[model samples]
Target: MMFGVNSKILDEIVCILSKDTNVESAYIFGSRARGDFKEYSDIDIAVFIEDPNKRNMIAVDINEINCIYKFDIVIIKESTSRELLDNIKKDGVKIYQRPF
Candidate 1:
């Protein structure tokens, strides 16, 4: 149960996403969240955004980050609806959460 990337990556992601108005909560999930990730396994990230229209910007940000870093992407919108957020939190590991 060891994580691949160091804590620096988490800090970097938090810092990067925090600066953007589109990003709400950025959660790290999959093997990394469970602490069973290997060097080959890409880090799974679940990003919750405030505006649904900003998804394109979120994707661009993630893609830009991935281009510089190595990881997989999964973006979810929190402000869009409660249903999806509940489902994601219930299903995916709650790596990060922003209080409304």
Candidate 2:
């Protein structure tokens, strides 16, 4: 898949993911999130959910206003551990945390 993203697109993705009932939080990771993207880098997203087993999630590509970006959703059990949160903190730059 062609990999690239911008703040406007990211905002749209966050909005979409937030609408999902299973999702509690959404985040962006990896190169695109770090502002050091190349021509080929899949946009990585971390999705926090009420239950991973509740449903299967997939990446959604939303195009509007001619903006392009890859949006991915990951589902984790709602009760996430501190370690995971810490890891997100350690790699915080890659995370585009949703604004509640």
Candidate 3:
């Protein structure tokens, strides 16, 4: 039910993303999270991880999982600007968090 995205598909996405050990958390933001998406709107996701080097690879892996929807992956690192992190925290909807 996330911005017209199928719940089953979202579940599958979560399952796939969870396989990445470096992913500390994931959030949905932008139009999809706000519920104002158009038919062509891309899915926006932000992933928080400790290792910045793994960002690109993680994005590639997620993109390879499915092609039914367009995805924009934003990788958040420990060194990310506080302002940007705060903005994301305020506007994003947390979709997944790895178990401690």
Candidate 4:
């Protein structure tokens, strides 16, 4: 598995995001995504959704999942910074994107 983290974690995360119709997409970035993560490395999850409040709610849902590492959730938006967006797009792994 990726970085020794539980695959169930990713499965549950995608399941949660897929349940939410508003979520346009989701990605896993940062050290974990790059396969250079240490034991203390946290999982960086970027969620693309319309409602900021709803996105926060989704983050809460994800946080409910128990794990050894922390989950750093970021909501992707039009107002997101170019640098971060570029990094995520360039290196991030897309986990889920709602069907059209």
Q: Give the C-alpha miss distance for residue 43 in model 4, angstroms.
A: 0.4
lDDT of 2 by residue, 7-89 (tens): 66656666666666766666565566566787655566667665677754435433232444444344445576777666555
Give the alpha carbon lDDT tens digit for every residue of 1-100 in model 3: 6767878867866886788888888998888887889887888888888677753476787787664788888888777788877767777888999998
Q: Please write out the lDDT profile of model 1 over residues 19-100, one tens digit for every residue.
A: 6776667766666666666667777777867676643454455555543346666666434367655545654664455645
Q: Count the backbone clashes (under 3 Å) in each candidate.
A: 0, 0, 0, 0
All candidates in order of lDDT, best leading: 4, 3, 1, 2
Question: How close to the true structure is residue 19 of candidate 2, measured as C-alpha lDDT?
Answer: 62
For residue 74, give model 4's deviation from the true position in Å. 0.5
TM-score of each: 0.65, 0.57, 0.82, 0.89
Q: Looking at candidate 4, what is the lDDT of residue 56?
A: 57
Residue 20 accuracy (lDDT) in model 2: 69
lDDT of each: 0.61, 0.55, 0.80, 0.86
lDDT score for candidate 1 against the true structure: 0.61
Weakest 10 consecutive residues, lDDT, candidate 2?
61-70
Candidate 2 accuracy as lDDT: 0.55
Most TM-score-accurate candidate: 4
| Number of clashes found in candidate 4 | 0
- Candidate 4 — worst ten consecutive residues by lDDT sum? 50-59
Candidate 2 residue runs with Cα over 4 Å from true position = 1-4, 58-73, 77-87, 93-100
